[model samples]
Target: MRAHHDRAARALGVICEGGTEFWGWAGRTLGRAGTATDGRRVWLRMLTAREAKATGKLWDGNQTAEKAFGTLGGRRPELLAVHDAAETGVVYRAELSTRLDMPVVSPDPVLRSPLSLSPGWWGSLRTALSTVAGATTDRVAVRSAYVERALPEFVGAPAPETIEWVTVHGDLHWANLTQPRLRVLDWEGWGQGPRGYDQATLLAYSLLQPDTASCIRECFPELGTAATWAGEAVIVAELLQSVARGDNEELAPPLKAWAKQLRERARK
Candidate 1:
């Protein structure tokens, strides 16, 4: 992945500098910060053969996102350049994007504790998410069949009779959020989903921190409310499924608790 990133930088005519290398989970993605030949700071990210699937729109989310939305008021990274190549049977994709100088809210996707954030940060985040939800896109981030099956098994039966679909940042977790000034990272999964999908996801990841979770509710009041129950159930089931897979082990208890509440609500 590093070799691919380096190759892409060379091809893109960016001068690689500094040792700030970051890798995605299981080293699926690798990126380095550098400046363009014209001295513009940028980030070059490369997908490894394992994580590189060139078939689906979801696979090329970052590039597609640029077409779908132009920065979303600077909350998302701007896609600048792309380099695609194949070595053997696998394809490697590298993208150059406008660099975000802020650090992420958390290294892990799930927040284990509370962190005080300014009102300005919350306001910015709220605006960005709202803008995404209002976007028009043909991309599908969540499917009906999976929601129908998973909801009954992981959450409960009696799915909502109606659903409002909207554009969402499919993977809106703590690690994907930046602080001080808001910036959402990893745009490879933005698409249409149940209306509150992103908010529900961010809430699920912040379950351990009740204060932060409450703050989130205040910021996005429609997220887990009765009107958005279907979206909430979808994301709850998704995360709980991840919990069952031994991925979010710590989130298991809270997710199950939330599921119990959802089951009761569904029954009602």
Candidate 2:
């Protein structure tokens, strides 16, 4: 135990003890040297082998997520009160100065079609189907005519053939996005492949309002046209990714709405 203590202290470069040992830090972070009354205002986390292994891929996603939040801040600067961010493990510690108090910027000045009822939303449904298409035997439960038509649209459009790849935030939802402040943080699973994947993931998770959804699309007019299809494709890949991880309909409202969207799209 003494050897463990010595090694830990050496790794941290400080003599830490008591419950601090269970804090599970991998390295020592230099903090402001101040009087005993002030204590260390900043913390340094020791990176573990596991964190190191996941850092590269997770960081890439984190950067993209950061960009998305930055975009939100750009559109509605007041929505996001960004406090600070610094490299720590695979994710960045982005601090928010304030919380969002208004409805999401869905169908706002940025997106054109509104994410709720827009064709882009269907993409999320299709993505969900793709996620479970490989697992459960209930193929009919996940089938859709919209995907049948939409899938063919991308057949030769410089996109992958299998609809198996795309950039997406594996987990997107309201909790990840602060309201009124509209700050977005947390970048755990992010990558590229289909389009609108992130938007769909977030929508599905948050159960956005229809009017708000429209605003979301309107806010991102670039996604209103053919570009929206690419976004949809990405959503499909991400949906399947989530299903494979064994996520179920704990958030039944969003899951139901997602299903309803596919059915509505199929009718069209």
Candidate 3:
């Protein structure tokens, strides 16, 4: 696939045999992720013109996440390089870290351990969140106006101003995380956003299994606060948008129910 990007470029052919992951929403090939000739495995993400616009400050996000790699401990992949692709937008390639021995427990029904995670795992997650919250970044992930507008669409109420904003892994879900090892991936959307947004997103994605959701809530008690409720509302609004975009159809039902529950809570 990289060869298709530039037939004349010799380096493109050096990409070894791994499949590509496409993001249909962006309407572009994310990149051909595989091992290189030098035996280094990497994920090369390509952002098309439209996708660059949709993502906003695409390069800044990579830089921020790269900076975070130093502080986030061993829980995230190391950023290898970022290159300008001219009309095609930027290209970000990172070293693919070793995944956990246990598969991710969400989205996929692969054989895995119980939904409950160890207390040490929870501590590492909190440590990662705290590390990210303290990291500085100039990007605005989900804007205040966006949250306000989206909340009304799903919950029939404005988001509370009491919610505190912090740097977050904007796209936090089962797919972006690995278990047992507890490594986080896909740093394209890392930026400043509402506190507890990541936790809310993880919980929302786990709603299909009550036990998993309960475990997440137990691990992150902050999810019960008003701020996290607002964060959940934001996530529900995003998921509804995804549903409208013809994505996440399977999650639509649970997402709607969760949104309605949050709406009812807001009424009081």
Candidate 4:
């Protein structure tokens, strides 16, 4: 995959600096820090999969985000160029984007512990989220059927009727956020979702850090309100479903506890 990524860089006329290479889950994506021919720092990402399975929203997400958000006031890396080729029934797509100098807050998606984040960082994050939510798009992130089907079974809460949908980052976890400053990444899942879904995702991942969780709730007070319960319930169920799949098992305890609390709240 690294070889393919490097070759893709050469083909795109970008030079990959040899030190750091970032790999995504299950080897589906590889990203490297690089420079354009003009020495402008850039990030190059390569993805490969069977040609038959590579056509969909996930495949086109970054391009779609580039067109839809247009750099997002420097909150997101700008997608600059793309290179595509196919070989032996596999498709390889490479994307060159503006590289962020700041690193992600964590190596994992779930924040097992807390880190001190400045008030300014939180403010920037809120602004970025608000801007994203205000955008208009036909893309769907969380489907009602999934929420209706999974909520009762996974979260023990009846699904809320008439969920208000809003645009969201869709995968707003720790690894997708940068440190000392705020930048959101992994935009492949950004689209319309039930209100508070993004905040719920962040809060769910912060449960192990109780203070952090409280801070998130404080920052987005709407999260604990009845209006956002529909979205929050779905996010909790989604992560619990992940636990059932043998992923993020550590979140199981807090998630189950939180689900129980949500159920109690529903009863009230």
Q: What C-alpha lDDT values do all the predictions have?
A: 0.85, 0.38, 0.66, 0.89
lDDT tens digits, residue span 86-131, model 4: 8889999999999999988988888876688999888888999999
- Candidate 3 colliding pairs: none
Best by lDDT: 4
Off by over 4 Å in 2: 1-55, 59-172, 188-193, 208-211, 222-224, 244-246, 250-268
Tens digits of per-residue lDDT, candidate 2, 13-34, equal: 4433334332222342211111
Q: Where does candidate 3 have its weakest 10-residue lDDT segment?
A: 5-14
Candidate 4 residue 171 C-alpha distance from true site, Å? 0.5
Identify the runs in model 4 with alpha carbons over 4 angstroms from their true place.
none
Error of 1 at 103 (Å): 0.6
TM-score of 3: 0.78
Q: What are the models' TM-scores?
A: 0.95, 0.39, 0.78, 0.97
Better of 2 and 3 by TM-score: 3
What TM-score does structure 2 among the candidates reach? 0.39
Q: Order of all candidates by lDDT, from best down to worst?
A: 4, 1, 3, 2
